[model samples]
Target: MTYLGEIHSRLLDHRPIIQGETRYFVKEFEEKRGLREVRVLENLKNVIQETNEQILPKCTETMQDYLSQTLQRLQAASHLVYKLQQKEQEQRKLNNQHLLISEKQRITQWEDFMTEQHNKQAAVDEEHRKATERLKEQYAEMEKDLAKFSSF
Candidate 1:
């Protein structure tokens, strides 16, 4: 193939990769779909490392390879970051709910304890009043007996 034909062929091959990046970046901007964890990005990382290794020594090759790889890496990072943020937010919400429930339970238990204490105090007070009344009756009877004996 002629030198110009070689360049044309390489450009044609790179067109798809560049377009793939463009598509994802555009999708990110549009926010048409919510982030979904389709798969682990271990493979993407491996691909980036491989692309970097190969593209660095051969600068004459298509520059589009680096552009494509860079964009893909950026998108993967963004997706992972978004996913982690969501998980953290959900955990915080659950923690708040748990704390609220525990607080309510503690309040109810305290109220119950207070009611029991009040009931016990009322019973003690009634018993003391009854005992005082009995003592007063006994003193009155003793006084009457003493007065009768003295008169005789």
Candidate 2:
């Protein structure tokens, strides 16, 4: 699936081969050095075992340190991701509030404009009624004046 996975699979598949090679090399070394001499063979075995024991603790410590560092880095990354998500949510809330405020302002402006238009219409109607009443009074006076002249 990935390069690391392939490498891990290959290592696992070759484990027996690696073990066989190690055994063969150790046997060859013993043969070349004349293992018939028991003391010499025993001494070499003891030396190899002791060296391996000494290095094992250091290797274990190094692996532990690497794992600890990796865990810390993962934790920090998780915290940062959480903070970013929180910030995004807050931003969305603020944007929604702004949109609501803008909508309310638009509605108020429309209402004010409607009220002003209604006031103007009412004023025009009142002026027309007053003009009509004045015209009626003038016509009545003119009729009375014609009647008097006709009688003379």
Best prediction by lDDT: 2
* Prediction 2 global C-alpha lDDT: 0.88
lDDT, residue 102, model 2:
90
Worst lDDT 10-window in candidate 2: 32-41
Pick out the ten consecutive residues of candidate 1 with the lowest summed lDDT.
32-41
The model with the greatest TM-score is: 1
Model 1 lDDT tens row, 1-152 = 69989888777768778899999988885575333322335667777888789866576355778888989999999999999999999999999999999999999999999999899899899898888888888888889999999999
Question: How does each model score on lDDT?
Answer: 0.83, 0.88
TM-score of each prediction: 0.45, 0.42
Candidate 1: residue 135 lDDT (0-100): 84
Pairs of residues clashing in candidate 2: none
Q: 1-152 in candidate 2: lDDT tens per residue?
A: 69989988777778778899999988887787555668777988998898789877788889999999999999999999999999999999999999999999989999999998898899888888888888888888888998888999
Q: Which stretches of candidate 2 lie over 4 Å from their true place?
A: 1-60, 121-152
Model 1, runs deviating above 4 Å: 1-67, 138-152
